[model samples]
Target: MSSSRAAVAGWALAACVYLLAQLHRTSLGVAGLLAEQRFGIDAGQLSLFVFLQIGVYAAMQIPTGVLVDRYGPRRVLVAAATIMGGAQLVFALVPLYPVALLARAALGFGDALTFVSVLRFAATHFSPRRYPVLVALTGMTGTVGNVAATLPLALLLRHVGWAPSFLGAGALSLVAGGAVALLLPDSTPPPRAVRTAAELRSGVLSIRGRVRRAWALPGTRLGFWTHFTSMSTGTALAVLWGTPYLVTAVGFSTAGAGAVLMVGVIAAAVVSPVLGWLIGERPSVRVPIGFGLSIVVVLGLVLLVTAFGDTPPAGPVVVFFVLAALGGPVSMAAFALARDYNHARSLGTASGVVNVGGFVATVLIALGIGWVLDLQGGTTARSLRWALLVAVAVQGFGVVRMIVWWLRVRATALHRQQRGEPVPVSVVRRRFDLRVTGPTGESGPGD
Candidate 1:
């Protein structure tokens, strides 16, 4: 198989595995009503349950980066997938609220490993020019997964019950784990045969040193902040909590809310790649700035309705979903910016930092929104409106972040060129010599 084909297959497998891993997190939104009735828990307690997952996942990201760097993605990912599956099984079988929360926390920690590992794999196997496209495509897979988690899971819950839905998700995760373990090739080589004992120690040290150096690069910081605060917060809130807010506050049914959330994701998945393509085709200030402006507009709409408008009105709900669709491309631009900034270094560090930032933002935002809900006397409509307002404000911060990044990129390019350094081209293609894998873990033939 060609390198391109192998990279494609490997990424497709990774995306599928990630989607399966994510089901536990997103499934809760649709299950909110059911869980409330069964457990007799109020909204605040239920929000805390989700918060437990986010907090665990956020805390685990930095270590996950180190694990990817030292242990290689193949081993780390297989372990994560297995743990994710086990947690889902526990979630399915457990009865008590505390036990379920424990299971959810376990699922959070397990699923935290997927994003960084997949990023490392993509950075190792694919060309630099192709990285953003692959990232966008992988992101789309996540949106698709969110859609499935909502509508399909809701439909499944309608007939089969939540326990069976979770059990089935666990089974799917196990199958995905096996496929990843078999199909994804390890990107690094084993220790050299002729090295002295001293040399062996130095080899391990050198690997750690490279990872450190990569983390310290200026580009890494620039990319990390851009994605973490602005891009990621929007995506997380929309996918994970969107349905619950819609149903609880807006009076939509479980299935109706699921369908609405699905539409939002489908719109985002469709729009993200187009923005990627536009950036690839033009590679200009206009594309990114316009992208940023578009998010501001969409988020502004969201903020307007949430802050000042009536929620039960059909006009506001219809407008909110349409605006929600516009957020996907903005996120795509942020991921692309990360790739563009990192240049020749380890994209894994950049990706990991961004992931860490985004999740941290999620924790802060989710908790803050919870507080706001309390302040609003705990009306579902008012609470949701407050959350939307918070999201819009956060997105405005993203717009500012992007503008700074653009200015920095421009200044750096000009400075380098004036100093007789090579002018960095918009599109760079770097070929790495790593054997790729398929869905079953067999190496691609002589790539």
Candidate 2:
């Protein structure tokens, strides 16, 4: 078989695991009420229960990145599939709420393993130029799984009853794991060389040292804040509270809420590639001072109104959904920023650090909403407005921190530019056009 074909086949299978991971990650959002009924829990307890999955996933990322680096992506992908499959089965069959929470935590652990593995797989197998596009597609695939967990999972639960629906989903994931174990090809190996003592020492650096070094970079911190601010609300909505809020607050039926969420996911998927292109190719289009903050602020204001105000008209609710969808893809910009500022050697650590912010923010947002709902006496329309306002307030704080870091990074970049060292093109946005020119004087790909 051609090497190219093997790469594609392997990615396709690993991507299935990622899809399952995302499906399970957001499964509680659709199943929140059902789980609540089955487990005999209040809205606040249910929120805490569901958000545990994401919390575990967020906390495990750096460790999981280490696993992928040491053990390789294929093995990690298989293990992730196996763990998630078992967790889902436990979630399906167990009548006890405590066991289900443990299952969700396991599912989150598995979910943490899958994304880093998929990224390592792509980085190993694909050419550099195609890597960014493939990464965008990977995110889009996860979005597809996220969309499925909404209406499709809801309909499945509706028709088949909760146990059969989740049981079947679990069974499918187990099968995917087996197929990956048996059929997936190993990543193409790079040429080996004798390692120097310094290289070996670097690889064994303590986790604290790795994180501290990465955190010291102003751009890395900017990336963290960007990820934190941009993705938390959208993710909280999709992964835990979005559907319930829509149904309880906006008078949408189960299917209607799912449909709206599904549309937003699809819209976000479509917009992702365009954003990826703008960042990778036409970066000069960015306004140096604020970068992507304008759209983020607009999305925040929309959420503020949607969450804090009295049951808004349907128009604003729909607008918030559309706008929040954009936030997911927008968070991808944070990774781009990490790539821009960090050395290639420290990129993985920086990326993992950046990755933590969004999910950490997500867990906090869900908790905030859940606690507020309890305070307001349940999940009524009036209660959700207050609940979501608490969540959005958390997001606003993240945005403020992002701006603070952005100013510092900008100042640092200017210092580097003044010293005549190479800096990321984004640092010079609107100050000067720095694209390379071809023979005919046309701008290069950096244009």
Candidate 3:
């Protein structure tokens, strides 16, 4: 096949995998209540299940980065998807709660591979300028997947029973896995020689050393940090807990909450690509990102207001909250930024590093917030209220972080220019490299 055709196929497969991964993530939102009733569990148990799922998922990011870099995304991704699908199958069949929780953990571990693979693929195949757009488009597809998880998934789970739903979703995951294995092309140049484990470790460490050089620059480091902090909080709230908040605190039913949350995700889907476009065209991510973060801050305040029963009358308040829900572009912007800023030497590693902040946030802050709610008498109303306040405070910290970073970057650039020092510049460029090797110890022109 031609290189262009191969790249297209790879991207298509990645999209499918991403869609399924997203479905797996959001599926739990609807299943939470059912799982609770079926197992006679409470909020703490549910939180623990989610905590375990995300914690394992988050911890696997770096390992996935390493594996993808070594073996290429094709094999690694297929293995993960298959594992995830099998786990889902077990979840569908298992009767015991403990077994189901273990299944969820396995599913999450497998699902974590999806995004890292997508990041690796984008860095290898797509042009740098186009990477942001592609990443945003990928996120938008995930939002579509989120939408599927909401109304369609809820309806399916209710009508077909959760077991059948899991089986069907598992089938979809396996198909996605097979498709990816068949489609994705390995781009990294084959090893010059079969190196020892120590050699591999040395090489990886060398890459990290170079990565630290890039991170030493204030603009790049600050950008990465701000992106991580914001998305960490946003994803924890929006992806994991938004439905519950709507269902319990806002007085929406499960199905209703699902539908409403889908709309919010749709809003995010529409805005993300636009933000990426703006960043590419305008040459400043801060404007769009800053605007989005402002929305999050506003949403936080609104939640705080609502908690105090000082919200505006019903009609406008719902609209306001829905608009607040639209603040997800900030989260999307963070993903785009991660794709945008990193040097190309070890793209997967850089992305993994950038993503770590958010993973920590989700694990620590998201889980901690749940624990806090449990302490606040373990009721949804009280927990949500407290969680909102915490989200507000956390988001406020993110905003301040971004603002400070922006100012520092600007001040440094001005200082450099005034001193007649060569200022670092930002521009997106294309890169293509071969992956396979020939018999005579030479690289094949793969791309």
Candidate 4:
């Protein structure tokens, strides 16, 4: 392949891994009640199926990043796909809940291995100028996976039965892994200072030390909080709650609920490139835009439930899903922040830390909502509405912290500029005011 074609092929295959990550991540949302029916589990246990996968995915981020550094993306990518496919096959045939849980856990492991490796891999393949748009598209590709897992997967389940559907899913995963192996262009690891990574792997540098060092940057934390507030609620909704709540609580037909989810994913796909361009054109807007998105989405959802109760009007509910899906693209700003502020060598760890924010939110809040549903004796209109309110509360809390960290990042940027440092200055919009912030901690490149 020509170099450009090779880059595209590699990126495309890597994106396939991410696509599966999102597919499995959101599979249970469509499949949740079915899984419950098959396993005879309650809401809380059903939540465990989704939440545990995410919890494991979140917990693996930093470690997976380290492994990508210590080993390489190829090994990690191949292993991840194999594990995911095999686990899904196991999940398809399993008759026991505990075994299913173990299968989901393995799936999470494979899912966790993907994006970091993909990001690190992309860093090696593409020029820095293309990075922002590429990151956004990565998220968009995952949303496409979400689309497939929705109505298509739902239809497959109806037509083919559970085991056959998932068997096909497993087979697809294995095929994707094989394609990646054959097509992704080989590249040398990007050069970077290895002392920190070397010691970190050898246990000379503690995991806490590396994590604390990365998190110590106010910009990194800003990215974390930005994603924490903006991303996960949409993810939580998409993962296990949106379809059920829409159908059972808001009087959406099953097809209507599936269409709503497909709408969200498609909307996210459309927005990702626009958001990526904004971030690339004006770095300052990264955090500010994320802040704005979180506030608007949280307020919109809050108003929807509070005003309409369980029987929200369809038109407004459609607006809510569009707004919520927009958050997925906005959250990509966190990666831009991590790329902007951290050194290239440290990018993997910082990215992993940044990556954890949303899924952590996804894990805790999804699990909490499941418990709340269980406590209320299932997905009643009242129970589902209350559960979503709980999600808003968490999102609201993240926005509060985002404000705190946003201010600190701005201050840190101003301080660096005053000290005769090289920072990419950009205009930040504040209430009735304009201010300055900084990024491109490196001269010509960013994450």
RMSD of each: 8.5, 5.9, 8.2, 3.8
The stretch of ten residues in a row with the least summed lDDT in candidate 3 is 438-447
lDDT-better candidate, 2 vs 3: 2
- Looking at model 2, report the run of 10 residues with the lowest lDDT sum: 438-447
| Winner by TM-score | 4
Compared with the true structure, model 4 gives a TM-score of 0.91
- In candidate 2, what are the lDDT values of residues 5-116, reduced to their tens digit? 8789888888888888888888877788788889999888888775788889888877776666556777778899989989999999999988988999999898888876
Taking all chains together, each candidate's TM-score versus the true structure is 0.82, 0.87, 0.83, 0.91
In the predicted model 2, the residue pairs found to clash are: none
Report the C-alpha lDDT of model 1 over 331-369, residue by residue, as the tens digit.
444545545555334455556665765566566656666
- Sorted by TM-score (best first), the order is 4, 2, 3, 1
Off by over 4 Å in 3: 1-5, 190-197, 200-220, 286-288, 291-295, 298-329, 339-341, 415-447
Query: What is the TM-score of candidate 3?
Result: 0.83
For residues 246-297, write the lDDT of model 3, one tens digit per residue.
Answer: 6776677778867776776788788878866775565455434554655555
The ten-residue window of minimal lDDT in model 4 covers 438-447
Question: Candidate 1: worst 10 consecutive residues by lDDT?
Answer: 438-447
Instruction: Name the best candidate (by lDDT).
Output: 4
Error of 2 at 420 (Å): 1.7
lDDT of each: 0.64, 0.74, 0.65, 0.81
**Measured by C-alpha RMSD in angstroms, how accurate is candidate 1?**
8.5
lDDT of 4 by residue, 41-94 (tens): 988898898777998999998888777765667767888888899999999999
The TM-score of candidate 2 is 0.87
Model 1 lDDT on a 0 to 1 scale: 0.64
